[model samples]
Target: MKVLAAMSGGVDSAVAAARAVAAGHDVTGIHLALSRNPKSYRTGARGCCTIEDSNDARRAADVIGIPFYVWDLSDAFHEEVVEDFMAEYAAGRTPNPCLRCNEKIKFAAVLDRGMALGFDAVATGHYAQLRTGDDGMIEMHRALDHAKDQSYVLGVLTQEQLAHSLFPLGDTTKDVVRREAADRGLLVADKPDSHDICFIADGDNAGWLREKLGDRNPNTGGDIVDSATGEVLGHHEGTVGFTIGQRRGLRLGVPAPDGKPRFVLDIEPVSGTVSVGPRAGLQIDRITGIRPRWCGTVPEVLDGPAVTVQLRAHGAEHRAVVAVRPAGASSEGAPMGVASDGSGSGSVEIELLEPAEGIAPGQAAVIYDGSRVVGSATISGTGRSHALAQTLQRVAT
Candidate 1:
């Protein structure tokens, strides 16, 4: 079988490619040049597609005795991932660009191109296991090393993409993977892991946005309003720095009703208004999500059985009842509804066992049935109409 390995100049990817070659598959390495100006990578920060990183990937591919090439997908990355990131933030929602990259670039665009070039599968350094279930359908599970598990970021992948995907380091820890790379003389073995968002290389997101959108940006910041009484508490420069469940840097001199700290309960980008209230205002017993993407065929039941819903990356998985309408009967513009049985298909309404905080639109809600990933959807909106009381818990939404 011909396989294409995505080498990101990281030890994990280098080892994944080596494992693919050892499995007797005809393997080739490709480093995606995601940034046109690779030299502009942040000082003392690690990121993908850097000129230095690409060189390291090429060296690793050479050590593994495989043909290597750099694929320039910078334009696509800018359009799909970078632009989408800015748009989501500008729209008063937090977005995970890594998930979008996997959904659109690595697994979709790169896989399609590789398949057209006769590669049977596209292998990556992602830490997630693909297993054959009892029914013979491919299932994705958390990697053995939970700390390194990347399944959450990959929840956007469809079954078609998973069919030809290979993850070689899912069963091992990061330390061991680096050790293996060291044994094979791969230079990235000692390379630090990439931290924060890759595109925001300096770890200064607000600064980066200021550069892109400028001072007269449309989604510019506005007043921080009170969620309960609609009174303006304070003013903010931008909403990009705020997300749901945020408790710090609010700088709101006014105290809550109980004289406790205030939290960001909601953000309205169109109106340039932010709603602040007690932390309890973040709890939502009900959630409405749209644009559901299944890793496999849509499940047989329109109404879901009990499942675990993962809202944030590495966030706690909460027990919930997820019900989908039949064949997408729910219009995209329709208001939120109760997650009752039957009707729409592509959308889901989730009822959590316990009210969760930090639920935000534009975030991915990945549903898991046991260890296998069932499906995932983007959060369109959240509701605290059911539980508006102030409550704090160890688990975050």
Candidate 2:
């Protein structure tokens, strides 16, 4: 099989490309130039796809004795991942850019181009396992190193995408991969893994958004109100500066009456109102997800003992029961009922057996059956736990 190795100028990806070579697959390496102005994005160890990263990828490809090229997908990346990030935040929702990158850029655009070039698959350094299931369809599972498992981000992949994808480092730990990189003479062996958003150079998300959004930003100095009392606690420059469950840097003029620190409970972008309250207000067990992407066969309902849902990339898994319905069906006042069949274009309703805190809309909810990834959905809305709602109501009274 001919494989296109996506070398990200990192130890993991270099080792992954090397492993693909070691596996005897006819491999070619390509580094995606995601940033139009490479210097605007992070440089050094904190960067993912800068010019330096492209050079590193090229050198790694040379060492591995594979044909290498750099694909400038900057326009596609800006329109898809970067633009989508700002828009989602402007609408008062937090988005996982990494997930979007994997969905729109890596697997979608890259895979399409690779197939056109006659490549059988696109391999990456992601720590997630792919197994051929009993049904003969490919199934994605968590990596052996749970601490480094990235299946949550890759959950957006579809059956077709999974069919043409490869993750060589999924079964191995990060330490082993680094050692393998050193053994293979890859220079990125001791390179620090990139953290935070790649496009944000200084890691100041709020400042970056403020500058980028400019006149279009809805968060131009709004009232920060206390949820319980409806009292204006302070003013904020923008709603974009706040996310659901943020507990710091609020800079409120008035402290909570009870002297307890408050968390951001909600952000209403249109009205530019950020509501702050106790952490308990952030507890939610019901999640409504839109734009569901199934890994393989779409399950009508998932209520098995091993059914679980991960709200965040590295967050704890919650025991959950999920029901699917058609996409345009009215979810308002709808009960969680098992659909006859879950179509690929349908939506999902997840009931967490245990409540999760600070679950914000626009985050991906990746469902898993044991170790197998069932699918993923972009979170559209969330409902507080019944008991928590009641308790809040009592407090209000």
How do the predictions measure up, each by TM-score?
0.90, 0.95
Instruction: Predict model 1's lDDT versus the native.
Output: 0.82
Taken over the whole model, the C-alpha lDDT of each candidate is 0.82, 0.90
Candidate 1 per-residue C-alpha lDDT over 274-347 given as tens digits, one digit per residue, 9 for 90 to 100 = 89887666778778877777777565333345478889888988888887754423467443332221112367
Q: In TM-score terms, which candidate is top?
A: 2
TM-score for candidate 2, residues paired by index: 0.95
User: lDDT per residue, candidate 2, 1-397, as tens digits?
Assistant: 9999998888888998999999999999999999999998887765396888888889999999999999999999999999999999999999999999999999999999999999999999999999999999899999999999999999989888899999999998999998888888888889899899999998899999999999989758899998878999899999999899999999988877778899999999999999999877888889999888888776779997899999998899999999987544345744233232222556789999888999999999999999999989999999976686887679757
Residue pairs in clash, model 2: 219-238, 221-237
Best by lDDT: 2
| Candidate 2 positional error at 128, Å | 0.4
